[model samples]
Target chain A: MPSSEEVFEKVQAALMDALGVDDDEVTPEATMVGDLGAESIDFLDIVFKLEKAFGINIPREELFPDDILTNSSYVKDGTVTADGISELKARLPWADLSKFEKNPRVQNFGNLLTVNDLCRYVESKL
Target chain B: MRWFWIDRFEEFVVGKQATALKNVTYSEEPIDDYLPGRPHYPHSLIIEGMAQTGGILIAQMQDFHPKVVLAKIGKAEFNSIVVPGDQLRMTAKLMSLQSDGAIIEGHVTVNHQPLAEMELAFGILDDSFGDTSFFLPGGFFRILRSLRLFEVARHEDGSPIQIPDYMLEAVRQEAAQ
Candidate 1:
Protein backbone atom coordinates (compact mmCIF):
# COMPACT_ATOMS: atom_id res chain seq x y z
CA MET A 1 0.00 0.00 0.00
CA PRO A 2 1.19 3.50 -0.82
CA SER A 3 1.54 6.19 1.80
CA SER A 4 -1.06 8.94 1.75
CA GLU A 5 1.52 11.38 0.41
CA GLU A 6 2.37 9.09 -2.48
CA VAL A 7 -1.30 8.63 -3.25
CA PHE A 8 -1.74 12.40 -3.27
CA GLU A 9 1.14 12.84 -5.72
CA LYS A 10 -0.21 10.17 -8.03
CA VAL A 11 -3.73 11.58 -7.80
CA GLN A 12 -2.45 15.05 -8.71
CA ALA A 13 -0.61 13.62 -11.68
CA ALA A 14 -3.75 11.84 -12.81
CA LEU A 15 -5.78 15.03 -12.50
CA MET A 16 -3.20 17.01 -14.48
CA ASP A 17 -3.26 14.46 -17.27
CA ALA A 18 -7.02 13.93 -17.25
CA LEU A 19 -8.12 17.56 -16.95
CA GLY A 20 -5.07 19.22 -18.51
CA VAL A 21 -4.79 21.52 -15.55
CA ASP A 22 -1.65 23.21 -14.18
CA ASP A 23 0.09 22.07 -11.00
CA ASP A 24 -1.33 24.95 -8.98
CA GLU A 25 -4.91 24.19 -10.02
CA VAL A 26 -4.94 20.59 -8.70
CA THR A 27 -4.85 21.46 -5.00
CA PRO A 28 -6.49 19.38 -2.28
CA GLU A 29 -9.41 21.77 -1.96
CA ALA A 30 -10.06 22.22 -5.70
CA THR A 31 -13.43 20.86 -6.74
CA MET A 32 -13.45 18.64 -9.81
CA VAL A 33 -15.98 20.60 -11.83
CA GLY A 34 -16.29 24.03 -10.23
CA ASP A 35 -12.63 24.57 -9.41
CA LEU A 36 -10.70 22.46 -11.92
CA GLY A 37 -13.14 22.96 -14.85
CA ALA A 38 -13.83 19.25 -15.32
CA GLU A 39 -16.80 18.51 -17.51
CA SER A 40 -19.18 15.65 -16.84
CA ILE A 41 -17.35 13.51 -19.40
CA ASP A 42 -13.91 14.07 -17.89
CA PHE A 43 -14.76 11.69 -15.02
CA LEU A 44 -14.42 8.69 -17.33
CA ASP A 45 -10.94 9.73 -18.38
CA ILE A 46 -10.02 10.34 -14.78
CA VAL A 47 -11.23 6.88 -13.75
CA PHE A 48 -9.39 5.18 -16.58
CA LYS A 49 -6.12 6.90 -15.74
CA LEU A 50 -6.53 6.21 -12.02
CA GLU A 51 -7.08 2.49 -12.71
CA LYS A 52 -3.96 2.35 -14.85
CA ALA A 53 -1.86 4.20 -12.27
CA PHE A 54 -3.06 2.16 -9.27
CA GLY A 55 -3.44 -1.20 -11.07
CA ILE A 56 -6.81 -1.63 -9.40
CA ASN A 57 -10.25 -2.23 -10.83
CA ILE A 58 -12.44 0.60 -9.60
CA PRO A 59 -15.97 -0.42 -10.39
CA ARG A 60 -18.11 2.31 -11.96
CA GLU A 61 -20.58 1.89 -9.15
CA GLU A 62 -17.84 2.62 -6.65
CA LEU A 63 -17.26 6.05 -8.17
CA PHE A 64 -20.96 6.82 -7.78
CA PRO A 65 -23.16 4.18 -6.27
CA ASP A 66 -26.10 3.65 -8.61
CA ASP A 67 -28.33 1.97 -6.08
CA ILE A 68 -28.22 4.96 -3.76
CA LEU A 69 -28.91 7.40 -6.56
CA THR A 70 -31.82 5.33 -7.84
CA ASN A 71 -33.34 4.31 -4.56
CA SER A 72 -36.70 5.98 -3.94
CA SER A 73 -35.91 6.42 -0.28
CA TYR A 74 -32.91 8.60 -1.10
CA VAL A 75 -34.16 10.61 -4.07
CA LYS A 76 -37.58 12.23 -4.22
CA ASP A 77 -38.79 14.17 -7.28
CA GLY A 78 -35.21 14.62 -8.55
CA THR A 79 -34.03 16.09 -5.28
CA VAL A 80 -31.74 14.37 -2.80
CA THR A 81 -33.14 14.17 0.72
CA ALA A 82 -31.15 14.45 3.94
CA ASP A 83 -31.02 10.63 4.07
CA GLY A 84 -29.51 10.59 0.58
CA ILE A 85 -26.81 13.05 1.60
CA SER A 86 -26.01 10.97 4.66
CA GLU A 87 -25.70 7.82 2.59
CA LEU A 88 -23.50 9.59 0.05
CA LYS A 89 -21.30 10.94 2.84
CA ALA A 90 -20.90 7.48 4.30
CA ARG A 91 -19.99 5.99 0.94
CA LEU A 92 -17.71 8.87 -0.12
CA PRO A 93 -16.11 9.73 3.16
CA TRP A 94 -13.05 11.11 1.36
CA ALA A 95 -14.94 14.13 0.04
CA ASP A 96 -14.79 17.42 1.97
CA LEU A 97 -18.38 18.37 1.49
CA SER A 98 -18.61 21.19 4.03
CA LYS A 99 -20.06 23.49 1.38
CA PHE A 100 -22.31 20.80 -0.10
CA GLU A 101 -23.66 20.00 3.35
CA LYS A 102 -25.05 23.52 3.60
CA ASN A 103 -27.25 23.03 0.53
CA PRO A 104 -26.83 19.90 -1.58
CA ARG A 105 -28.38 19.21 -4.96
CA VAL A 106 -28.74 15.81 -6.54
CA GLN A 107 -27.47 16.85 -9.98
CA ASN A 108 -24.57 18.89 -8.65
CA PHE A 109 -22.83 16.41 -6.34
CA GLY A 110 -20.36 15.56 -9.07
CA ASN A 111 -19.37 19.20 -9.17
CA LEU A 112 -18.93 19.22 -5.41
CA LEU A 113 -16.26 16.49 -5.48
CA THR A 114 -12.67 17.56 -4.83
CA VAL A 115 -9.17 16.40 -5.82
CA ASN A 116 -8.39 15.39 -2.23
CA ASP A 117 -11.46 13.21 -2.22
CA LEU A 118 -10.10 11.13 -5.09
CA CYS A 119 -6.68 10.88 -3.47
CA ARG A 120 -8.18 9.60 -0.23
CA TYR A 121 -10.40 7.15 -2.11
CA VAL A 122 -7.46 5.73 -4.05
CA GLU A 123 -5.39 5.46 -0.89
CA SER A 124 -8.16 3.49 0.76
CA LYS A 125 -8.31 1.12 -2.22
CA LEU A 126 -4.56 0.56 -2.07
CA MET B 1 -27.54 -14.78 -41.18
CA ARG B 2 -25.35 -14.43 -38.12
CA TRP B 3 -25.19 -10.79 -37.16
CA PHE B 4 -22.25 -9.55 -35.11
CA TRP B 5 -21.28 -5.94 -34.52
CA ILE B 6 -17.70 -6.83 -33.69
CA ASP B 7 -15.72 -8.98 -36.11
CA ARG B 8 -13.56 -10.85 -33.55
CA PHE B 9 -11.76 -10.60 -30.27
CA GLU B 10 -8.01 -10.06 -30.48
CA GLU B 11 -7.08 -10.45 -26.81
CA PHE B 12 -9.00 -11.84 -23.83
CA VAL B 13 -8.82 -13.15 -20.28
CA VAL B 14 -11.35 -15.75 -19.18
CA GLY B 15 -13.30 -13.36 -16.98
CA LYS B 16 -11.25 -10.26 -16.29
CA GLN B 17 -11.03 -8.37 -19.58
CA ALA B 18 -10.95 -8.52 -23.39
CA THR B 19 -9.89 -6.49 -26.45
CA ALA B 20 -11.62 -6.74 -29.81
CA LEU B 21 -11.50 -4.95 -33.16
CA LYS B 22 -14.07 -3.88 -35.72
CA ASN B 23 -13.42 -2.50 -39.17
CA VAL B 24 -15.65 0.11 -40.75
CA THR B 25 -16.05 -0.36 -44.49
CA TYR B 26 -18.21 1.34 -47.09
CA SER B 27 -19.64 -1.95 -48.26
CA GLU B 28 -21.27 -2.82 -44.93
CA GLU B 29 -25.05 -2.47 -44.86
CA PRO B 30 -25.32 -0.19 -41.83
CA ILE B 31 -23.00 2.45 -43.23
CA ASP B 32 -25.16 2.73 -46.32
CA ASP B 33 -28.51 2.24 -44.62
CA TYR B 34 -27.92 4.86 -41.95
CA LEU B 35 -27.38 7.65 -44.44
CA PRO B 36 -27.43 7.25 -48.22
CA GLY B 37 -24.78 9.83 -49.05
CA ARG B 38 -23.07 10.41 -45.71
CA PRO B 39 -21.37 7.21 -44.63
CA HIS B 40 -20.28 7.14 -41.01
CA TYR B 41 -20.75 4.58 -38.26
CA PRO B 42 -23.68 5.59 -36.13
CA HIS B 43 -23.27 6.08 -32.37
CA SER B 44 -25.93 3.45 -31.73
CA LEU B 45 -24.05 0.79 -33.68
CA ILE B 46 -20.80 1.82 -32.03
CA ILE B 47 -22.45 1.22 -28.64
CA GLU B 48 -23.77 -2.15 -29.84
CA GLY B 49 -20.26 -3.07 -30.85
CA MET B 50 -19.07 -2.29 -27.31
CA ALA B 51 -21.98 -4.24 -25.79
CA GLN B 52 -21.27 -7.26 -27.99
CA THR B 53 -17.61 -7.23 -26.99
CA GLY B 54 -18.44 -7.12 -23.26
CA GLY B 55 -21.34 -9.59 -23.53
CA ILE B 56 -19.24 -12.24 -25.24
CA LEU B 57 -16.43 -11.82 -22.70
CA ILE B 58 -18.93 -12.36 -19.86
CA ALA B 59 -20.44 -15.39 -21.61
CA GLN B 60 -17.05 -16.97 -22.18
CA MET B 61 -16.19 -16.40 -18.52
CA GLN B 62 -19.21 -18.47 -17.50
CA ASP B 63 -18.03 -21.18 -19.94
CA PHE B 64 -21.11 -20.51 -22.10
CA HIS B 65 -23.38 -22.59 -19.86
CA PRO B 66 -25.89 -19.78 -19.54
CA LYS B 67 -26.82 -17.67 -22.54
CA VAL B 68 -25.65 -14.07 -22.12
CA VAL B 69 -27.73 -11.22 -23.47
CA LEU B 70 -27.29 -7.44 -23.46
CA ALA B 71 -29.66 -6.38 -20.68
CA LYS B 72 -28.75 -2.71 -20.54
CA ILE B 73 -26.31 -0.13 -21.78
CA GLY B 74 -26.02 1.71 -18.52
CA LYS B 75 -23.91 4.49 -19.99
CA ALA B 76 -22.36 5.33 -23.37
CA GLU B 77 -20.47 8.32 -24.70
CA PHE B 78 -18.80 8.92 -28.07
CA ASN B 79 -16.02 11.46 -28.31
CA SER B 80 -14.98 11.23 -31.93
CA ILE B 81 -16.28 10.42 -35.38
CA VAL B 82 -15.57 6.99 -36.91
CA VAL B 83 -15.68 6.57 -40.66
CA PRO B 84 -14.59 4.14 -43.35
CA GLY B 85 -11.02 2.83 -43.17
CA ASP B 86 -11.07 3.29 -39.40
CA GLN B 87 -10.19 0.23 -37.33
CA LEU B 88 -11.86 0.45 -33.95
CA ARG B 89 -10.18 -1.31 -31.04
CA MET B 90 -12.62 -2.08 -28.24
CA THR B 91 -11.54 -3.20 -24.77
CA ALA B 92 -13.92 -4.57 -22.14
CA LYS B 93 -13.10 -5.13 -18.46
CA LEU B 94 -15.34 -7.05 -16.10
CA MET B 95 -16.54 -4.89 -13.21
CA SER B 96 -18.80 -7.27 -11.26
CA LEU B 97 -20.15 -10.72 -11.97
CA GLN B 98 -23.09 -12.35 -10.23
CA SER B 99 -24.92 -15.63 -10.79
CA ASP B 100 -27.67 -13.82 -12.66
CA GLY B 101 -25.88 -10.90 -14.33
CA ALA B 102 -22.71 -8.87 -14.84
CA ILE B 103 -21.55 -5.28 -15.31
CA ILE B 104 -18.73 -4.40 -17.71
CA GLU B 105 -16.71 -1.31 -18.44
CA GLY B 106 -15.55 -0.82 -22.00
CA HIS B 107 -13.80 1.70 -24.21
CA VAL B 108 -13.07 2.08 -27.91
CA THR B 109 -10.23 3.77 -29.70
CA VAL B 110 -9.11 4.37 -33.24
CA ASN B 111 -5.39 4.71 -33.83
CA HIS B 112 -5.00 4.99 -30.06
CA GLN B 113 -7.35 7.97 -29.87
CA PRO B 114 -10.40 7.69 -27.68
CA LEU B 115 -13.58 6.95 -29.61
CA ALA B 116 -16.10 5.94 -27.00
CA GLU B 117 -16.63 4.67 -23.45
CA MET B 118 -19.43 2.34 -22.35
CA GLU B 119 -20.91 0.66 -19.30
CA LEU B 120 -22.76 -2.49 -20.26
CA ALA B 121 -24.90 -4.86 -18.19
CA PHE B 122 -25.63 -8.44 -19.19
CA GLY B 123 -28.12 -11.03 -17.92
CA ILE B 124 -27.73 -14.79 -18.11
CA LEU B 125 -30.59 -16.27 -20.10
CA ASP B 126 -32.18 -19.28 -18.42
CA ASP B 127 -34.17 -21.66 -20.55
CA SER B 128 -36.19 -22.76 -17.52
CA PHE B 129 -37.59 -19.22 -17.40
CA GLY B 130 -39.01 -19.32 -20.92
CA ASP B 131 -35.77 -18.18 -22.50
CA THR B 132 -35.08 -18.62 -26.19
CA SER B 133 -31.78 -19.43 -27.85
CA PHE B 134 -29.68 -16.27 -28.24
CA PHE B 135 -26.39 -18.02 -28.94
CA LEU B 136 -24.25 -16.64 -31.68
CA PRO B 137 -24.25 -18.73 -34.84
CA GLY B 138 -21.82 -21.66 -35.11
CA GLY B 139 -19.70 -19.57 -37.45
CA PHE B 140 -18.79 -17.32 -34.53
CA PHE B 141 -16.26 -19.88 -33.32
CA ARG B 142 -14.60 -20.00 -36.70
CA ILE B 143 -14.05 -16.27 -36.47
CA LEU B 144 -12.82 -16.68 -32.90
CA ARG B 145 -10.30 -19.28 -34.02
CA SER B 146 -9.08 -17.05 -36.84
CA LEU B 147 -8.56 -14.22 -34.38
CA ARG B 148 -6.49 -16.46 -32.02
CA LEU B 149 -8.77 -16.00 -28.98
CA PHE B 150 -8.00 -19.48 -27.63
CA GLU B 151 -4.28 -19.02 -28.18
CA VAL B 152 -4.11 -15.68 -26.41
CA ALA B 153 -6.45 -16.27 -23.46
CA ARG B 154 -5.16 -17.05 -19.94
CA HIS B 155 -6.38 -17.01 -16.32
CA GLU B 156 -5.14 -14.65 -13.62
CA ASP B 157 -2.45 -17.11 -12.52
CA GLY B 158 -1.11 -17.34 -16.12
CA SER B 159 -2.50 -20.87 -16.64
CA PRO B 160 -4.41 -21.64 -19.83
CA ILE B 161 -8.10 -22.42 -19.55
CA GLN B 162 -9.48 -25.36 -21.43
CA ILE B 163 -11.60 -24.51 -24.42
CA PRO B 164 -15.25 -24.97 -23.52
CA ASP B 165 -17.02 -28.00 -25.03
CA TYR B 166 -19.66 -25.86 -26.72
CA MET B 167 -16.98 -23.80 -28.44
CA LEU B 168 -15.33 -27.01 -29.63
CA GLU B 169 -18.69 -28.16 -30.90
CA ALA B 170 -19.24 -24.86 -32.67
CA VAL B 171 -15.89 -25.18 -34.39
CA ARG B 172 -16.76 -28.71 -35.42
CA GLN B 173 -20.14 -27.62 -36.77
CA GLU B 174 -18.53 -24.82 -38.71
CA ALA B 175 -16.01 -27.20 -40.20
CA ALA B 176 -18.75 -29.64 -41.17
CA GLN B 177 -20.60 -26.90 -43.01
Candidate 2:
Protein backbone atom coordinates (compact mmCIF):
# COMPACT_ATOMS: atom_id res chain seq x y z
CA MET A 1 0.00 0.00 0.00
CA PRO A 2 1.14 3.51 -0.82
CA SER A 3 1.85 5.99 1.96
CA SER A 4 -0.56 8.78 2.77
CA GLU A 5 1.63 11.33 0.99
CA GLU A 6 1.81 9.18 -2.13
CA VAL A 7 -1.96 8.73 -2.11
CA PHE A 8 -2.40 12.49 -1.83
CA GLU A 9 -0.08 13.04 -4.75
CA LYS A 10 -2.04 10.68 -6.98
CA VAL A 11 -5.31 12.18 -5.85
CA GLN A 12 -3.97 15.66 -6.54
CA ALA A 13 -2.85 14.69 -10.02
CA ALA A 14 -6.26 13.16 -10.73
CA LEU A 15 -7.97 16.36 -9.60
CA MET A 16 -5.61 18.49 -11.69
CA ASP A 17 -6.44 16.48 -14.80
CA ALA A 18 -10.15 16.07 -14.06
CA LEU A 19 -10.82 19.64 -12.91
CA GLY A 20 -8.18 21.50 -14.96
CA VAL A 21 -6.83 23.03 -11.77
CA ASP A 22 -3.25 23.97 -11.01
CA ASP A 23 -1.21 21.89 -8.59
CA ASP A 24 -1.22 24.56 -5.91
CA GLU A 25 -5.00 24.96 -6.18
CA VAL A 26 -5.49 21.31 -5.20
CA THR A 27 -4.42 21.90 -1.59
CA PRO A 28 -5.98 19.67 1.02
CA GLU A 29 -8.26 22.45 2.21
CA ALA A 30 -9.65 23.17 -1.27
CA THR A 31 -13.23 22.15 -1.80
CA MET A 32 -13.74 19.90 -4.82
CA VAL A 33 -16.62 21.94 -6.16
CA GLY A 34 -16.46 25.50 -4.85
CA ASP A 35 -12.68 25.84 -4.86
CA LEU A 36 -11.90 23.82 -7.98
CA GLY A 37 -14.99 24.54 -10.08
CA ALA A 38 -15.90 20.90 -10.59
CA GLU A 39 -19.33 20.34 -12.06
CA SER A 40 -21.49 17.25 -11.68
CA ILE A 41 -20.07 15.77 -14.89
CA ASP A 42 -16.53 16.22 -13.64
CA PHE A 43 -17.09 13.74 -10.81
CA LEU A 44 -17.44 10.93 -13.34
CA ASP A 45 -14.18 11.88 -14.98
CA ILE A 46 -12.48 12.09 -11.60
CA VAL A 47 -13.76 8.67 -10.63
CA PHE A 48 -12.41 7.17 -13.84
CA LYS A 49 -9.01 8.75 -13.30
CA LEU A 50 -8.76 7.76 -9.65
CA GLU A 51 -9.77 4.19 -10.39
CA LYS A 52 -7.04 3.95 -13.00
CA ALA A 53 -4.43 5.66 -10.86
CA PHE A 54 -5.07 3.63 -7.74
CA GLY A 55 -6.19 0.35 -9.32
CA ILE A 56 -9.20 0.30 -7.02
CA ASN A 57 -12.88 -0.03 -7.69
CA ILE A 58 -14.89 2.97 -6.50
CA PRO A 59 -18.60 2.45 -6.25
CA ARG A 60 -20.47 5.65 -7.13
CA GLU A 61 -22.57 5.65 -3.98
CA GLU A 62 -19.50 5.43 -1.75
CA LEU A 63 -18.19 8.79 -2.90
CA PHE A 64 -21.38 10.49 -4.01
CA PRO A 65 -24.44 9.67 -1.97
CA ASP A 66 -26.80 11.38 -4.40
CA ASP A 67 -29.51 8.89 -3.57
CA ILE A 68 -29.46 9.86 0.11
CA LEU A 69 -29.39 13.55 -0.63
CA THR A 70 -32.30 13.26 -2.99
CA ASN A 71 -34.30 10.81 -0.95
CA SER A 72 -37.52 12.41 0.38
CA SER A 73 -37.33 10.52 3.63
CA TYR A 74 -33.98 12.08 4.53
CA VAL A 75 -34.73 15.64 3.44
CA LYS A 76 -37.28 18.08 4.82
CA ASP A 77 -37.77 21.67 3.61
CA GLY A 78 -34.68 21.31 1.41
CA THR A 79 -32.46 20.56 4.43
CA VAL A 80 -31.08 17.20 5.42
CA THR A 81 -32.83 15.93 8.55
CA ALA A 82 -31.01 14.61 11.64
CA ASP A 83 -31.43 11.09 10.32
CA GLY A 84 -29.83 12.16 7.07
CA ILE A 85 -26.81 13.45 8.96
CA SER A 86 -26.47 10.13 10.75
CA GLU A 87 -26.68 8.29 7.47
CA LEU A 88 -24.05 10.55 5.89
CA LYS A 89 -21.75 10.05 8.86
CA ALA A 90 -22.13 6.29 8.60
CA ARG A 91 -21.54 6.33 4.86
CA LEU A 92 -18.65 8.79 4.90
CA PRO A 93 -16.52 8.13 7.97
CA TRP A 94 -13.50 9.79 6.32
CA ALA A 95 -15.32 12.98 5.44
CA ASP A 96 -15.61 15.91 7.84
CA LEU A 97 -19.33 16.53 8.04
CA SER A 98 -19.26 18.70 11.15
CA LYS A 99 -19.46 21.90 9.10
CA PHE A 100 -22.31 20.56 7.01
CA GLU A 101 -24.15 19.29 10.07
CA LYS A 102 -24.71 22.87 11.28
CA ASN A 103 -26.75 23.68 8.16
CA PRO A 104 -27.39 20.61 6.06
CA ARG A 105 -29.01 22.23 3.07
CA VAL A 106 -29.05 19.80 0.19
CA GLN A 107 -27.53 22.37 -2.16
CA ASN A 108 -24.63 22.98 0.20
CA PHE A 109 -23.80 19.29 0.21
CA GLY A 110 -22.30 19.58 -3.27
CA ASN A 111 -19.55 21.81 -1.91
CA LEU A 112 -18.87 19.73 1.17
CA LEU A 113 -16.19 17.42 -0.20
CA THR A 114 -12.67 18.71 0.48
CA VAL A 115 -9.41 17.52 -0.95
CA ASN A 116 -8.42 16.17 2.42
CA ASP A 117 -11.62 14.19 2.67
CA LEU A 118 -10.90 12.66 -0.71
CA CYS A 119 -7.38 11.71 0.39
CA ARG A 120 -8.77 10.06 3.50
CA TYR A 121 -11.33 8.14 1.50
CA VAL A 122 -8.62 6.93 -0.85
CA GLU A 123 -6.46 5.94 2.08
CA SER A 124 -9.30 4.00 3.62
CA LYS A 125 -9.74 2.13 0.35
CA LEU A 126 -6.03 1.37 0.23
CA MET B 1 -25.56 19.65 -43.51
CA ARG B 2 -25.26 16.07 -42.63
CA TRP B 3 -23.66 15.80 -39.20
CA PHE B 4 -21.15 13.22 -40.32
CA TRP B 5 -17.56 14.22 -39.56
CA ILE B 6 -16.03 10.85 -40.36
CA ASP B 7 -16.06 9.55 -43.95
CA ARG B 8 -15.25 5.86 -43.44
CA PHE B 9 -13.89 3.39 -40.90
CA GLU B 10 -10.45 2.18 -41.89
CA GLU B 11 -10.23 -0.30 -39.00
CA PHE B 12 -12.66 -1.40 -36.27
CA VAL B 13 -12.28 -3.85 -33.39
CA VAL B 14 -15.32 -4.60 -31.27
CA GLY B 15 -15.11 -2.96 -27.84
CA LYS B 16 -11.50 -1.99 -28.43
CA GLN B 17 -10.38 0.56 -31.01
CA ALA B 18 -11.45 2.15 -34.31
CA THR B 19 -9.76 4.22 -36.98
CA ALA B 20 -11.75 6.49 -39.31
CA LEU B 21 -10.88 8.86 -42.13
CA LYS B 22 -11.92 12.49 -42.67
CA ASN B 23 -10.82 14.39 -45.75
CA VAL B 24 -10.84 18.15 -45.56
CA THR B 25 -11.66 20.05 -48.73
CA TYR B 26 -11.99 23.70 -49.75
CA SER B 27 -15.53 23.11 -51.00
CA GLU B 28 -16.87 22.51 -47.50
CA GLU B 29 -18.40 25.77 -46.27
CA PRO B 30 -16.84 25.51 -42.77
CA ILE B 31 -13.36 25.49 -44.25
CA ASP B 32 -13.68 29.08 -45.46
CA ASP B 33 -16.51 30.40 -43.27
CA TYR B 34 -14.80 29.51 -39.99
CA LEU B 35 -11.92 31.89 -40.52
CA PRO B 36 -12.74 33.63 -43.84
CA GLY B 37 -9.20 33.20 -45.27
CA ARG B 38 -7.73 30.43 -43.14
CA PRO B 39 -9.24 27.66 -45.26
CA HIS B 40 -8.41 24.95 -42.74
CA TYR B 41 -10.49 22.42 -40.83
CA PRO B 42 -11.75 23.76 -37.55
CA HIS B 43 -10.42 22.06 -34.44
CA SER B 44 -13.97 21.66 -33.10
CA LEU B 45 -14.97 19.54 -36.09
CA ILE B 46 -11.87 17.41 -35.63
CA ILE B 47 -12.93 16.82 -32.03
CA GLU B 48 -16.40 15.85 -33.28
CA GLY B 49 -14.86 13.42 -35.74
CA MET B 50 -12.91 11.79 -32.94
CA ALA B 51 -16.01 11.74 -30.75
CA GLN B 52 -18.04 9.98 -33.43
CA THR B 53 -15.34 7.39 -33.94
CA GLY B 54 -15.07 6.81 -30.18
CA GLY B 55 -18.82 6.97 -29.64
CA ILE B 56 -19.45 4.27 -32.22
CA LEU B 57 -16.79 2.06 -30.67
CA ILE B 58 -18.54 2.34 -27.30
CA ALA B 59 -22.05 2.01 -28.69
CA GLN B 60 -21.20 -1.15 -30.59
CA MET B 61 -20.04 -2.81 -27.38
CA GLN B 62 -23.71 -2.84 -26.27
CA ASP B 63 -25.07 -3.49 -29.77
CA PHE B 64 -25.95 0.21 -30.02
CA HIS B 65 -28.62 0.14 -27.34
CA PRO B 66 -27.32 2.86 -25.08
CA LYS B 67 -27.86 6.51 -25.97
CA VAL B 68 -24.14 7.30 -26.00
CA VAL B 69 -23.35 11.00 -25.93
CA LEU B 70 -20.07 12.88 -25.61
CA ALA B 71 -20.30 13.97 -21.99
CA LYS B 72 -16.90 15.62 -21.57
CA ILE B 73 -13.58 16.23 -23.28
CA GLY B 74 -10.89 15.60 -20.68
CA LYS B 75 -8.07 16.81 -22.84
CA ALA B 76 -7.52 18.09 -26.40
CA GLU B 77 -4.24 19.31 -27.88
CA PHE B 78 -3.51 20.27 -31.48
CA ASN B 79 0.11 20.29 -32.53
CA SER B 80 -0.35 21.34 -36.16
CA ILE B 81 -2.95 22.95 -38.38
CA VAL B 82 -4.88 20.80 -40.88
CA VAL B 83 -5.62 22.72 -44.07
CA PRO B 84 -7.66 21.73 -47.08
CA GLY B 85 -6.48 18.66 -49.00
CA ASP B 86 -5.37 17.08 -45.73
CA GLN B 87 -6.69 13.58 -45.18
CA LEU B 88 -6.96 13.08 -41.43
CA ARG B 89 -6.74 9.62 -39.91
CA MET B 90 -8.51 9.71 -36.57
CA THR B 91 -8.14 6.78 -34.20
CA ALA B 92 -9.95 6.17 -30.92
CA LYS B 93 -8.87 3.51 -28.43
CA LEU B 94 -11.03 2.49 -25.54
CA MET B 95 -9.12 3.20 -22.35
CA SER B 96 -11.85 2.48 -19.82
CA LEU B 97 -15.36 1.08 -19.96
CA GLN B 98 -18.12 0.99 -17.38
CA SER B 99 -21.89 0.72 -17.33
CA ASP B 100 -22.46 4.44 -16.77
CA GLY B 101 -19.81 5.74 -19.18
CA ALA B 102 -16.61 5.07 -21.14
CA ILE B 103 -13.40 6.95 -21.88
CA ILE B 104 -11.37 6.96 -25.11
CA GLU B 105 -7.91 8.13 -25.94
CA GLY B 106 -7.91 9.53 -29.46
CA HIS B 107 -5.21 10.60 -31.88
CA VAL B 108 -5.32 12.36 -35.24
CA THR B 109 -2.56 12.11 -37.76
CA VAL B 110 -1.88 13.12 -41.36
CA ASN B 111 0.68 11.12 -43.33
CA HIS B 112 1.89 9.61 -40.03
CA GLN B 113 2.57 13.06 -38.59
CA PRO B 114 0.73 13.86 -35.38
CA LEU B 115 -2.04 16.46 -35.66
CA ALA B 116 -4.06 16.24 -32.47
CA GLU B 117 -4.47 14.09 -29.34
CA MET B 118 -7.53 13.97 -27.10
CA GLU B 119 -9.20 12.21 -24.18
CA LEU B 120 -12.98 12.06 -24.45
CA ALA B 121 -15.70 10.71 -22.13
CA PHE B 122 -19.04 9.35 -23.26
CA GLY B 123 -22.06 8.88 -21.01
CA ILE B 124 -24.86 6.35 -21.38
CA LEU B 125 -28.09 8.21 -20.89
CA ASP B 126 -30.67 6.34 -18.83
CA ASP B 127 -34.47 6.41 -18.66
CA SER B 128 -34.49 9.78 -16.94
CA PHE B 129 -33.65 11.43 -20.29
CA GLY B 130 -37.14 10.28 -21.41
CA ASP B 131 -38.22 7.73 -23.96
CA THR B 132 -37.38 10.00 -26.89
CA SER B 133 -34.85 8.50 -29.27
CA PHE B 134 -31.94 10.47 -30.71
CA PHE B 135 -32.50 9.05 -34.19
CA LEU B 136 -35.36 7.52 -36.10
CA PRO B 137 -35.62 3.74 -35.85
CA GLY B 138 -32.88 2.03 -37.90
CA GLY B 139 -31.51 5.43 -38.96
CA PHE B 140 -28.09 4.87 -37.37
CA PHE B 141 -27.75 1.34 -38.83
CA ARG B 142 -28.07 2.88 -42.30
CA ILE B 143 -25.42 5.46 -41.41
CA LEU B 144 -23.09 2.72 -40.14
CA ARG B 145 -23.50 0.73 -43.33
CA SER B 146 -22.68 3.76 -45.48
CA LEU B 147 -19.52 4.36 -43.40
CA ARG B 148 -18.34 0.78 -44.10
CA LEU B 149 -18.01 -0.05 -40.39
CA PHE B 150 -18.86 -3.74 -40.80
CA GLU B 151 -16.37 -4.23 -43.61
CA VAL B 152 -13.41 -3.71 -41.27
CA ALA B 153 -14.95 -4.56 -37.92
CA ARG B 154 -14.05 -7.81 -36.09
CA HIS B 155 -14.47 -9.33 -32.70
CA GLU B 156 -11.44 -9.77 -30.41
CA ASP B 157 -11.53 -13.47 -31.27
CA GLY B 158 -10.88 -12.55 -34.94
CA SER B 159 -14.42 -13.47 -35.96
CA PRO B 160 -16.27 -11.00 -38.16
CA ILE B 161 -18.81 -8.83 -36.38
CA GLN B 162 -22.39 -9.12 -37.52
CA ILE B 163 -25.17 -6.58 -37.36
CA PRO B 164 -27.35 -7.14 -34.35
CA ASP B 165 -30.72 -8.82 -34.97
CA TYR B 166 -32.55 -5.83 -33.51
CA MET B 167 -30.99 -3.48 -36.06
CA LEU B 168 -31.83 -5.80 -38.96
CA GLU B 169 -35.36 -6.13 -37.64
CA ALA B 170 -35.67 -2.35 -37.37
CA VAL B 171 -34.45 -1.99 -40.94
CA ARG B 172 -37.07 -4.47 -42.14
CA GLN B 173 -39.79 -2.65 -40.23
CA GLU B 174 -38.71 0.66 -41.72
CA ALA B 175 -38.61 -0.78 -45.22
CA ALA B 176 -42.17 -2.03 -44.86
CA GLN B 177 -43.31 1.43 -43.77
Going through the candidates in order, what fraction of the true interface contacts does each contain? 0.00, 0.33
Badly placed stretches (over 4 Å) of model 1 are: A1-126, B136-140, B166-177
The CAPRI classification for model 1 reads as: incorrect
lDDT of 2 by residue, B78-172 (tens): 99888888999999999887667888999999867998999999888888988787776488889999999989999989898989898889999
lDDT digits (tens) for residues A1-126 of candidate 2: 999899999999999999889999999999999999998778888988999999998988999898899999999999999999999999999999999998899999999999999999998998
lDDT tens readout by residue for model 1, B93-129: 9976655567688889987899888877676666765
Score residue A95 of candidate 2 by CA lDDT. 100
| Candidate 2: clashing pairs of residues | none
Error of 1 at A33 (Å): 32
**Candidate 2 residue runs with Cα over 4 Å from true position:** A70-84
Against the true structure, candidate 2 reaches a TM-score of 0.89
